[model samples]
Target: MIAPVENKPEDVPPAVVDEEEAEDGEDGAPETQGAGGEGKKKKKKKKPKKKKLEQTEPPSIGLSRLFSDGNYPEGEIQDYKDDNSYRTTSEEKRYDERRMMEDIDETYNNIRKAAEAHRHARKWARKFIRPGMRMLDIADGIEDAVRTTVEANGLEAGIAFPTGLSLNHCAAHYSPNPGDTLVLGEKDVLKIDIGVHVRGRICDSAFTLSFDPTYDPLLEAVRAATDTGVREAGIDVRLGELAGYIQETMESYEVEVNGKVLPVRPIEHLSGHTIHPYQIHGKKSVLLYKNEDQTKMEEGEYFAIETFGSTGRGKVVEQGEVSHYARRADAPHVPLRLTSAQNLLKSINKNFGTLPWCDGTSSGGGEQLNHLVSQGIVQDYPPLCDVRGAMTAQFEHTILLRPTRKEVVSRGDDY
Candidate 1:
C-alpha cells in the first residue's frame, strides 16, 4: 500500500536568510559593521560574506517525479513527511490500498536484483566455459545459477530468454537442444548471451569468447562498437547516427584470421532493440549501419544495445534449427484436444509472463510444446548464422535513457 514517507532532516531545504544577507542588508542596503550613526557618511568596514545556498526542487506533490495522485489538486504540495519532500498523500486510504509506491519499490528493486544476478551468471559462465566444455551443460548450468541466485534473494526470477551459446559461424540464438551433445574445441569462437528477469524487468547483455588468438581483433571490434553505441544513445538522439557510429567503429579494424586479412563487418540484419518491462524487443530498432529511418530515441525508455562483428560477410540468415518459443499473440487460445496441451499452455502463461522462454524448464516436455507450436499458440526462434563461415562476436548492454544522461544497468567489470 502507498504509505506516508518519514521526514528526513537532511533532505530539508536550508534557510535562505544568509543568502539574502549576502546580497543586500535586511533593509535592502549594505549594512556597515562599524558604528556609523544615523545618515552620516563614513568609511564602512565590510562584514564576513555569507555563502550562497543550493537551490531546492519545488514542493508540488502532484507535480513531483514519482507521485501524481489526482486527488491532490495541482500546485498543492503534500508534505506528509513535513520536510518539503513530495510524497503520496496520507489522508486518502483508497489510494493507499492501490499501493503504487510499494509496487514501484518492488519493481525497481527486482530490476536491480536481476542485473546483479545476470552479472554473477556471466562471471560464473566465464570460468565454466573452457575448451571442450559441452554447450548444453554451459547453458543449463548458467540458467540454473541465475534462477537459484534470484530465488535466494527473496523473489521469484527466471531467464528472460533461452541461454544462448552460439559457436563459430553462428551469430545468435543457438541454445542446445535436449540430449544434443556438442563440445567446445580449441579453435572455436563462442558467443555467450545471457538474460535474467525479476518480476519481468529484464537485463539482456552478452559478450564473446575466443580460444584462438587470431580472432582478437573481431572481439575488440565488437566491444568497441558496443561502447560507441552506448556513448551516442541519448534522449531525442537520432537512431541512424548511433547506427553509423557503431558501424564505423567496427569497420575500422582489419583483422588477420585464417591466413588472410579481412575487414570486420557488422551483421546488418540484427539491430539493437528497445526493451520494455516483460518485453525484450520493444518499438525502436538501432541499426548496425546507417539507414534512411530517422527514428529519435525517446526519454523514459530502456534499450538493449547489441552489436555483432564478424570476420566474414556481415549478412546472417536463419538456420533450420528452432528450439526457443514465445507466444505469438495475446488472444485467448482455442480449445485443444489434448489435456497436456491445455496444461502446458496455462503453465506458460503463469510462469513466463510476456517474455520469451524455452522448453528447458518445462515439465510438459518438447512433444507437448511442439503440439502447441503447431497449433499457433507459440512461435519458434531459429538460430541466425553467417553464410560465409565467419567467426562472429557480440557485445550488448541494457540502458535507461534519462533527460541528461543514460544509465547502464547491466555493466560489469570486464565491460
Candidate 2:
C-alpha cells in the first residue's frame, strides 16, 4: 500500500567530527618526565573515548540526489523496487537478464528524473500561486521553473505538455493563450496539471487548489480517490476493478455550498491513461468509475492514475476556445493548399513534435493553425468543463509497473 503523505522533516546536515589533539602542559608544551634522573622523557596521557553519534533514518530522496546523480536514497528503495525475482538458474539467462535489467534501470532513472522535476516545480507552484494572479503569469511561472530545473534543451529533456491551469468547472485541457487576460478568483477551484519529460520519459501528475474553505470536502474527495487509484494499481490488476475503488472513495464525500449539500460525484468521462515514450496518452485507459473494460495492466507499463470529482453534473463536455493542440502520432500524409498552414505544420514538427502545446508556445495563430486542425494534421484539445455554476476537482500521479514491484515515481512529500 502507498503510504499517505506526511509533513516532511527539516533537513539536518551531517555533524563534523574534529580530530582529537594531544594533551599539553600549562605552558602549551608537551608534558614530559625525567627517566631515572638521567634524561627528560615524554609522558603519554590517556585520551577520553569519543562518544558515538546517534543514528536515525536518512531523509527521503529529493531533487538534489536526482539531479546530481541518478541514485535514489536508502529510504526510497521501496518506492523504486517492488520485487526481487530476477535470480535465475542458468548462467546464460542470468547474463541476458542482467543486460535487460540494465536497460530497465536506465529507463527508470529517466522517468524518476522527470518525476522529480515535476514534483519540485509543482511544489513551488503550490506556494507561489494565489488568487488574483493572471492565468498567463501562472503558466509562465510553472513552465519556466520546469524548464530551468530540468535544464531542458531541444527534445532531450523539457516540459512534457503545456501547463494546465484549468479552473472552476474546467476539469482539464485548459491553459492560458498568448494574450489571455483571465485572472484567478478566490472562489475558483484550480487544477494544476503538470508534465515533465527526460528523453521522452514523461512524468504526468496534477493536483487541485481551492482557496475557499467550503470546497475542502470536494478537494479531499478527489485527492483520496487518486490515492485509492494509486494504491490499488499493480501488475495484472483489472482497470475496471481499479476504477470501482476510485469511484467508491470519491462518491463517499459530500460538500455543502450555499446551504446546499452536494455529493461529490466522479466524472465518468475523464479517465487516467497509460503513458508512453513521447506520448502522453497511450492505448489503454484507466476509467474513473466502474465499467466493463477488463483490460489488465501488464508489467513495464507507465500509467498516470488520475481522478476527477465534481459538485455539479458528473459529466464534462468540451466547451471553450481551443488552446491546446498536438501533432497526431499517426497523422496521415495529406496535401495542404495554404502555404501558411504548411509552414505552421513544419514549425510544429520542428519544435513541439508529438507533445501537446498551447498558442503561447506555437506561432501563426488564427486560421493558419485552425486549417491544420481541420486537415486532421493536428488534434485540438479544448477546455473540458462541467456545468457553469458547479465546481470540479482533480488529482493525479504517475506509476510504473516494474518487474518486481510497482513504483510510484511521481510520489512526493506533498500531493
Candidate 3:
C-alpha cells in the first residue's frame, strides 16, 4: 500500500526520487590510557583494541534468495492495552472489529505526526551536511537533530535504524569505527535512516543523500526510478507492479548514463514493508519480486516504496551480517533501551518483532534486540541485506493507501 504521487508542489524543488536499500556487528574495544610526561620523561600507556578490520562479506546471494520473504527474520506480538479495548479483531463481529479499527486509526494519526516531525528534523540537518565531513559526526548531528525535534514536537521518544552514515560501496552499517581514519570524500553517496515513535506507534524511514556533483547522474537515475515507482503506486495497482515499473525505469537510466546496458542491481530483499502505528517492517511486505499474493495492492494499507540502482552488476551479496540482522520475536527475549523496539513489540505481538542491534559497535539503546517467540517476547522481521558495491542510491516515501487515491504521509518540499 504505497501512496499515490501528487502534483510536485511548487514549493518543492524539481528533483529526483527513488529506491534503494542494514545491520550491526561490532567487537568491543578495551579502555586505553594516554601517555604523560612527568617531570623529565614518562612513557605513554598502551592503547586498547586495534581498529576493526574492514569486514568483507561473502559472494552475492542468488537473486532468488534476495527476494524470498523468508530471508527476513519475523517476530510476533501478543500484548496490547487490555483495559483500553483498542485492539480487538473478531471476524464474526464486524461492528466490534470496526470500532477497534477506528481506535487504531486515531492512535495511528498521533504516530504519523511524530513521524512527520522526525523527518523534518532530518531534512533540516541536510542543509549543513556536505563533503569532507566525518560520517560519525554526521550521525551525531542526526541524533541531536532528531532528539531535539522529537521533544520539541511533543513526541515521547524514537529510534533510528542503521542510523547509518554509509558512504560509497558501503550499503549499510558504514558508520566509522572508533579511531578509524574514515572521512567522507568528494562525490560520495551517503545513506541516512531514521525511526520515531509517538504514543507507542513507530515510523521507520530512510534517505540516501549524495555530495558528489559527479554522481548527479546516479542520483538522477534513482530519482527517476523513484518517481516512476511513486507515480505508479496507486490504490488498485499490484505490489509487484511498482517494482516492475521501477526496474524498467532504472534500466533505461542505466543505459543512458553508462553508454551501455549496465545491469542495475534491483535489491530484491530490500522492498518496502508495512507499518502499523509505531511498529515498522510489519507482517505484510510490498515485495520487489513477483509474488501472486503481492500482485494485488489493497486500499487502507500503507507502504514505503524504495528503489536502488547500483553501479556494479545488479547483483548483491549478504556479507554475513546475520549478526546484524534482527532476531525473531520467537527467537528469544532480552532487555533493551530503545523505546521504539519496546513499543513495536507490544503492537506487533511481542512475538512478532525483534529489537535491532547495530553489531554492538555504536553506543545506543537496543543496539540489537532479541525475543522469544514461544514466550511471547518478540520476533524479528527481515532486516536489510547489504549491497556489494560502494556506489548505490535510494529514495522512499511513506504513503497511505485509499480506495481510489493515496496520500504521501512524508511528503516534503524537496520531493
Candidate 4:
C-alpha cells in the first residue's frame, strides 16, 4: 500500500546502537569483548551516561544542514492536492537540493552534453532516413548513436525513452517492434523523438523531418508553436496562458495541399510535459491550444514544450497501434496465471521503475506483456494519428525555468 504524504517531514533521530543485541549463537543476550582470545565469561563495565545540554534561544547556529540550499519549489506545488505521488520530505529536500546546487554547474554541463547527443542522433537521422529504411533498423541506429555519444563523456548516461520514429499520420508513440518490417516512403513525414538522461537528469525533445517539401508549412507551424510557448513561459506565468500563445501562433500558419489552402492547427489532444529525475512527464503540461488549465510555472522547474501541427483536424485519436509501455502509477500487486507474466512483471519493476519502454526492448515476449496489460499494471501508449489523411509535424525542447529567464537545453539547428 502507498503511504500518505506528510505536509512537514518529521525530524530524523540520531543513530543509536543497542548494546544488548545477541550474536549468531546467542538468543537475545549481550556479548562483551575481553583481553583473552578465547570466549570467556567476564563481568560487564557500566559507563556513566553523558549529560545533555539544555539551551533555549534561537533555531539557528547548528541548523545549517537543514536550513541552507533547499530546492523546494517556491510559489509552486505548496501542497499535494494535485500531485499523484508522496510529498518531498525535509530530508530529501536538504540532501537533493544541497547536492544539486553544489554540483549545479556540473549538472548543467552533463545535461547539455546529453542534449547534444540527442541532437547529434537526430541530425544523423536526417541524412540516413531514406525511402527504403526499415523503422526497426532506424531505431537501432539512432539509439546506438545516443549511447555511444553519452558514454564518451565518462559519466553515467543512457537513452531516456525508446526511440519513437512515428511516420506520416502517426504523430507519436510508434516505436518499432524487433521484427517490424515497415519501411519508409519518399513522401513520409517522420518524427524523431529521442531522450538522454545523465545521472537521471533528462532532456526530452523531438523534431519532424519531411521528405516532401509540401509539408513544410506543417513543420513550420509546429516550430512556431513551440517557440511561442518558450517565449511566453516564465517563473510567474500560468501554464494555460503560455498554452494560449502557442495555439494562437500555430493558427496563423496555413498549409497548401493540392490546389486548396487550409489553416494548420495544433493537435489538441497532445501537449508538452515537464520532466524530472528518471520520470519524463513530470508536473505541469503546456497545451497547444488554450483551455482551462491553471497550473502555474514555478522557478527551478523544468519543462519540455512541444507542439504537433496537423494538416487535418487538430485532434489525434488512438488507432490501436501500441508500441510503448509505462508502469501504471497505481501498480497493483496481483498474481498472474502464466509464469511468463510473472517474470515480465519482475523485469519491468526492476529495470524501469516508472519510465516508458518498448516491449521489444524487454526480455519477455508479446504474450507476457499482454498478461500484464490485462491486469492494469501496464499502460500501452497507442499511436496517435489524425482522423483525416493529414500530415503530422512536431518540434520540442527541454528547458529550465528560472526566476528571470528560461534555459533551453535541447535547442538545436531544428529550432
Best by TM-score: 2
Report the lDDT of model 3 for residue 70: 19
lDDT string for model 4 (1-415, tens) is: 1355644322423243244532412433345455776554444466787553321121111211322342211211222222312324446544655565568456655566667666667766676778888888888888877776555332246777788888888888999977788998888899988988776778888888887899888888888888778767766677887888998999999988898998898888999988877678876888887887888877578889888888888788898567888878677887788988888888887776677888777778578898788889888888898965788888888887643335687876556
| CA lDDT, every model vs. true structure | 0.73, 0.81, 0.52, 0.73
Error of 3 at 288 (Å): 3.7
Clashes of 2: 2
Rank the candidate models, highest TM-score first.
Answer: 2, 4, 1, 3
In the range 1-415, model 2's lDDT, one tens digit per residue, is 2554643323323242222223454332455567666544345556797653321112123344344555532112232213333422446545654564589547777787788777668877888899999999999888887887676877888889999999998899999887899999999999999999988989999999989999999999999999888877877788998899999999999999999999999997999999988899999998988988889998679899999999889999999888889999988899999998889888998788899888767877688988888888899999999999889998998987765556778888887
lDDT at 191, model 2: 95
- Model 3 Cα shift for residue 209 (angstroms): 2.2
Q: After superposition, which runs of candidate 2 have C-alpha atoms over 4 Å from their true positions?
A: 1-66, 70-101
TM-score for candidate 1, residues paired by index: 0.72
Residue 320 shift from truth in candidate 4, angstroms: 3.7
RMSD of each: 14.3, 7.7, 22.3, 18.8
Clashing pairs in 1: none
How does candidate 4 score on lDDT? 0.73
- Measured by lDDT, the strongest candidate is 2
Residue 318 C-alpha lDDT in model 2: 94
